[model samples]
Target: MRWRVAFPGICVLLLIAVILTSQGERHVSLSDGVVAYFKRQQPIFAEKTVQLRRHIEQLQPGDSTSLLAARQALRECRISYKSIAFFLEYFFASEAYVFNAPAKYEIEEPYIEYEEPVGLQQIEALLYDPQVWQHRPELAAQATVLVQTAQDLHALLYQFSATSAQVTESIQQELIRIMTLYITGYDAPLLKSGIAEAAAAMKAIDTMLTPYQDLDKKDSIKYYLQQGIHMLSTQPDFDSFDRLSFLVNNALPLQRLLLNSNHDLFSATALKKDVFPHKDITGDTALGRRLFFEKALSGNATRSCATCHQPERYFTDGLMRNRSLTGNEVLPRHTPGLLYAAYQYSQFWDGRVQSLEEQVKAVMHSPQEMNANDDTVLHRLHNMPNYRGISLLQVQASLAAYLRTLAPFNSLFDHYMAGNKQALTDEQREGGNIFMGKGQCATCHFAPLFNGLIPPRYNRTEFEVLGIPAVDDLTHPLPDMDSGRLAFFPIGFYKGTFKTPTVRNTAVTAPYMHNGAFRNMEQVIDFYNKGGGNGIGLSVPNQTLSAVPLQLTPKEKKALIAFMEALTDRDPIAH
Candidate 1:
């Protein structure tokens, strides 16, 4: 009788063991799960897109209620897009631009392709204008186009497939997207719904990561995601939102957790291939350093790269424009600092060259600049004890390598982002918020690099037609005559277009803009506050900068300048 009673308990234990074995044997495909998640999200996104278009169709310019309804619909559409943005953007980047691109005409070089401003950003620009009635037809048309693209995207979603590796990689890229674009109000400048969109994106990432929760034993990623979403949702105010605190406390920790969990899925070496395109030579840094200060590379043998790019002034000469080779006239454009030059996709103000090596060679040969003859320079280098066997190519490589070392991410602002709360003051924090929100500086000067290199991909650099004045006289300004990228590309949209440089060391690198018209950060801020060159009454039909005044208070402007000042590197480049 006792044996019979034990037998039943044994059977129960055996049954439990069998169930556990079956559960362990069943393999869950993360890729399939991710694709299915996207399919479900597509319909939601499509419906929201249709809703936005309908709201726009019924919009009455003078009707306040209608306008408010349309704005709410726009917010909904943006949030829905954010939910699946990671997959959509990673797979269909070109098609994705149709749904949300910048509100300006753009020319893609090499192909000479022209793209008109369209999508949600274009609609937002029109709707948020004080004179919405004036742009009624344009707003309706943009909304209609957006709905059509959404339909196309929905159809394309049926064929979507991703490897488990891609799913994790996409999540990582989305994290970068949130940090760079979404939080900065890049896409939703007028609506200021970037925070909400960021939350939606994180939620989607959290859902995708659910299958891997067991893999993350600590569950730190889930905790941070929830925390970040809560903080974003609670803070509705765009200008006063504490972005620094959010980034340091939540977003950064989650990023580290994800990166550590999936070391095999993403390799640092592979990502560096995208970031630093060229093959970086080993054991050449010391040689490159010596060549950077070598005066013999120039035609006159009087000026080295350091002469124009002085280390004392953050690698800039601190002039409106440096003197030409003969010292008879000034160089055509302003001498930009070399502090973070290597981080850009393209070099120079006009973005004519795509590599630092190419830029170095161009400067060496330019008559108005270094004015060096290849044979002569090679001969001079051969005589030097350290650079005896160096060819012209080696010289170019060395100089490029040296430039790559200039990026030292130890600024006060960087420390603040890295979790040092006292690195920034209250005024500096307010200034940073304004820069990311109302000022719209982050739209062009993206975070981390704070340059024109587009984020998430970082494959292309952006050029903008700011329509800079020839002088600082906003009251009686003249449009700069410099053709910029147009001189080489011969495209109408490229007129007066220049690459956006990093503003990291701007407090030290004075004489701003392509022409160096603005002498100080205050002047530059004022120029932008008044709405670039177009708002100041200059004739610039192709100006890409919005012609709307920033409407900043005096204190805000001072704080903005102070925030930029805080970007100065902790370790000086002067040795």
Candidate 2:
């Protein structure tokens, strides 16, 4: 009886002690830490913007000292922006666009809303102009706008609130952005401050991860961050950096670690709003497989989806451009491989449609393609025993479900990344090095997906003006007549722009480019090597691809092809 009484007294004492200890050392939640981090970064960014504005105001015609100071100040502002970029971009995307958007007018399609380009990139372009003094008024005006935007962001931070889950998601996305955008110098093309900015971003991530007590691989994460930051800081050169090695060694591992742990927490939420949410995907895929090959779905009851995207040829019809339903003339564009098409933010070479379902509707309704009306498609489905009860939307959902399953990451390169060292030959590895480094292919064709879908968020697909010629004549290249994305958007900036397709399965998929200008991979490499059509003296003013020659030797070109060949899936063709 005495021992039991003493035990109760001891429990009470321990509870009191626990309360005292908890009160003495307040536990900072991950949400609190993230909010704190943003708060801390806000003033720093604002100060940098102010300094940048001051430098811009002090500029004089042919004043090198003032010019140098302004440039340095701009670099500092960029570094500060990078530290908070992940959070700003993920949480406040519309507002953040004013911080570092591309220096080109962008139109939000479907909505057709116009957004004038502003931010750091605009200032950088003006500052780095050959005749900078001539653009002083524009420069000063942009700087003032930038300063105001920074102040706006500072005010916005007061209302910023992120859960632990959101913070973790932001960090994971930042890892992807670092790999796809930052290291490649996507935005900082002129300034070339990408490496330094990447380092700053990594350091911010290190700080952000501090409050997560459940992070089991914290040491490994810290090591990767340290190593990556060191690499970026020490070897700041853009062209010669061993980007492939960095990706394979540090960034990829770190990305996988965080993402794998957070997969269950955020996977469903990460999916695009355009995707049709399905419960029984396996059932849908099996049903859709039959409908995919049904000729009755076409208006003429002749060509099917499989007729153009045949399974034997990795979903391509082995044609530069497939014959139309009439079989009299060729289609407008090449039949893009359906293997990884579902992963992109949009469908078609021009990316007019946002979802696979929408793409299905467009293709079926098109006069040249399938040319099937809703009534015809419904009537066809009504006769089919399995699809009788399904609505047209249900049919589209089933097809999209099947499309999503095509991405099987079992390629030789995927295996190599998965720790099978012998999966890739040394020559292929060298090719990869060139592709990521001097070749600069990875800048447009990001890894894993190797498509135009911009990573971290994967919410946008990029369009590039490559200046692909009408015919394979490098000597006297004639620009393709295809207006590309400009046909729909009708913007000068979008003229000649086409979505960057996946380079995966390039070994088999021949007659590349939207217009099918290249007959083989060798021809494709030669075209890019000569610096696209612009380098070969085509009048391509809006060419996104650099006109400067890649200068790849013959041996390097072969290796590059080998690397691309390794992207072929190891398993049987999914289509």
Candidate 3:
């Protein structure tokens, strides 16, 4: 009787164990789920494209009603496109460029002949303008191109497939991109439709992650997503929106959580090699130190690399412009500090070179700079008994290696971002808020790096047309005469454009701007407050800086300066 009772109990326990085991073995594939979701979105996007084309076709000559309809249709199309933005940007990057690339093209991109702006942005620029009626045919042509691109995007969605890791990584990157670019009004710079588009993107993310709701930590992730969407939905005006709060509270924490949940899926993708790859020699070593300070690399041994890049003054020569090797003329531009130069994709004020090694070669070969050719440099090094076997290539590699080690990101601000609240004082923290919020510094400078390398990818550097004054006097202003990027690009809009340099050690590296026109940070702040050269009565048609005054108060201006000073890195190696 006892054996019979025990057998029944055993059977019940065994059945429960089998069910639990089966449940444990079962795994829902998120990759397949996401693929299905993308496929579903294809038809919706196609229909929206058709609607956009129809609206464009319905444009009657000088009819406000028809134009209004067209604008509405265009906004609807943007909304539809934004719904699948994360997937499109990740899987179809090249094709997506045709959908909404920047209006301007880089001069270095020789493969693209007659680089005219095409895509949604091109159409939007025309449609939104009051003068669009005058250029109806041009607007119509751009609309047709947008229609075809949207169709291509729809077709391409069917070919999309991603691993779970890829999906997770792409989502994480998209979140960061949304906060950094989309929220900052970069994507819809002319339209000011950033808030609406951001909402659409958030909705899309919610939809994409819905199928994976049963995963571990789903509740917490869902909470963050909902909170972010709520924050975006309730945003005030574009200018007054608390971007600092949004970034620190909503966006950043959400990104961290998402990344942590899929820690195993995250890995560094292969970065493009610098134009000239250096051997594994870091600057902290004795050999790298020797190469960096070596004067033999110069044709005239009167100066070394450290001559212009003095370690005592935060790697800057503390001059408006450095004297040339001949000591008769000055270099064209101000000497930019080498503190965080390694993080940039391109070097020099014009962004003509691709690597630090290439920059070294250019500087050495230039008559105004070091004035040493590769052969001459090698010969000089060969004559030195200690450097007898050193080649020109080795010199380049060693110097580049040393410069790469100068990327010190450990500022008090960096520590604050990493989680130490006490890293900033009340005044500094308030100033930081204004910098990101009212001042609009974060839009161009970006975060952490305070450079225009554009995060989440950081592959390409950016150039901006600030229209800095020819002289410091605002009352009698003239545009800086340097052709700047136009010297190399030869494009009309690129005239006076310069690469955005880092403000990392700006406190120490005074005499700001490419021309070193500003004597102090106060002057720089005042210039920006007055809305760059254009606002100060200088004729700069293509000035990228906003023409509207920042209207920063004396207190706020002081705070902004304080925040910049906080970015000063603790030197890893003092002279």
The most accurate candidate by lDDT is 1
| TM-score against truth, every candidate | 0.89, 0.81, 0.80
Ranked candidates, highest TM-score first:
1, 2, 3
Lowest lDDT block of 10, candidate 2: 1-10
lDDT of 3: 0.68
lDDT of 3 by residue, 74-145 (tens): 777776777777787877776766666665443334332444666666677677666878767887777777
Cα lDDT, model 2, residue 565: 91
Candidate 1: tens digits of C-alpha lDDT, residues 1-575 = 00000000010000001101123213246677767887789888889989988888888758999899999999999999999999878778777777777777655556766678888788888888789888888888888787777777667756666655566667777887887789888888778899889999999988887655644455477788888889988996777777777777788777767666322111222124224434454326677788889999999898889899888888898899999989999899999888878766677887777678889889999998899988899889898898888888788887888787787777888777766789999989888888877788888887767877666666566788887999988899987899998887787777898988989888878989999999999989998888888889998887878778888889999989989988888775742
Error of 1 at 528 (Å): 1.6
| Residue-by-residue lDDT tens digits, candidate 2, 1-575 | 00000000010000010101132123336667777788899888989999999999899988999999999999999999999998898788876788888766665655556666678987887888778999888888888887788777757767667655566666766777787778877677667687788889998998876443234554466677777888988988866676767777788666645654432111223333333322342338776777788787789889788898887888888888888889889898989988877766667888787678778768888889989888977887788787787777776767777777776666788777766778899899888877766676876786656776555545557788888999888888887999998997787767888888988888888989998888999989888888787888898887777666778899989999999999887663643
Quote model 3's TM-score: 0.80
**Could you tell me how far off, in angstroms, the CA of residue 28 lies in candidate 2 after the best superposition?**
3.6
Q: Top model by TM-score, which number?
A: 1
